[model samples]
Target: MLLKSITPRESEKIIKIDRFVFTTFANIEALEYELSLGIKKIEAINTNYYLKIGGNEERIAFEAKIYLEYLEHFSGLVEKIKAREPLSLSTLESTKIRKILIDSFSAKTKDWLLDSSRNATYYTKEFSIGGVVL
Candidate 1:
């Protein structure tokens, strides 16, 4: 007997994966404000990740850590730019910084998906169809 496999419907599957892109940008803005006020020591910045399936949501912790590291890297670049001249970045400079963050995060996420240990089970559950778990 050939058993058929069942997959989740489009509505049940993960509909959106949200990264803390804006949150990182906002934190960097706040950091710049503090620096302008002569604040040397700044608090750590954190990022978050979320997966949505219909009305359900799952918070991703491990991936958030990786994202936080990249956020810090971007923050360092901003600090360097600030140190050179306490002025806002030029249009070209802003574009380069945005590209760096986009490319770096894209590459990292691709690499992460390639790892065998990283599976959908992290945010999904096994479902049985006709007494068979697929």
Candidate 2:
């Protein structure tokens, strides 16, 4: 996926990937310079190292199964977002929507969002004026 093109503004950092929106107060020019290079796909592998002992095999297998399930769920979610599927806010509760918003961010951006001292704020009123309420 490519980073969506946006006009750089003072004191505002907005990055869009597919349907996800990431906002923060950081160096936008630096981010834009990084994106100007190119977008590269990075492959990640999850490995589990454990001793073949009593009960360990079962535990490792259970953990592996959970990890695979999570990967599958995340992959499907990404595909849906990339496809720009229609969102029905009326059918989804607030917590579920919040989870989707949080999951949309990249790991680093998500960390920033979760940081209590970051003082992040969502512009609900602005979004509402544009026809989106969340």
lDDT winner = 2
| Weakest lDDT window of 10 consecutive positions for candidate 1 | 125-134
- Model 1, TM vs. native: 0.14
Compared with the true structure, all predictions reach lDDT values of 0.23, 0.26
Q: 16-86 in candidate 2: lDDT tens per residue?
A: 32233323422222221111223334455775444333221100000011111122222343454455444
Q: Candidate 1, after superposition: displacement of residue 51 in Å?
A: 57
What residue pairs are clashing in model 2?
A: none
What is the TM-score of each predicted model, taking all chains together? Answer: 0.14, 0.19
Poorest 10 consecutive residues of model 2 by lDDT?
A: 56-65
Enumerate clash totals for all models, in the order shown. Answer: 0, 0
Task: Enumerate residue pairs that collide in model 1.
Answer: none
Give lDDT tens digits, candidate 1, residues 1-134: 31112222323212111111332212221111111222234345674444333432211111122232333323343343334322222121133211111111211322233247666322111111011000
Candidate 1 residue runs with Cα over 4 Å from true position:
1-69, 75-134
Best by TM-score: 2
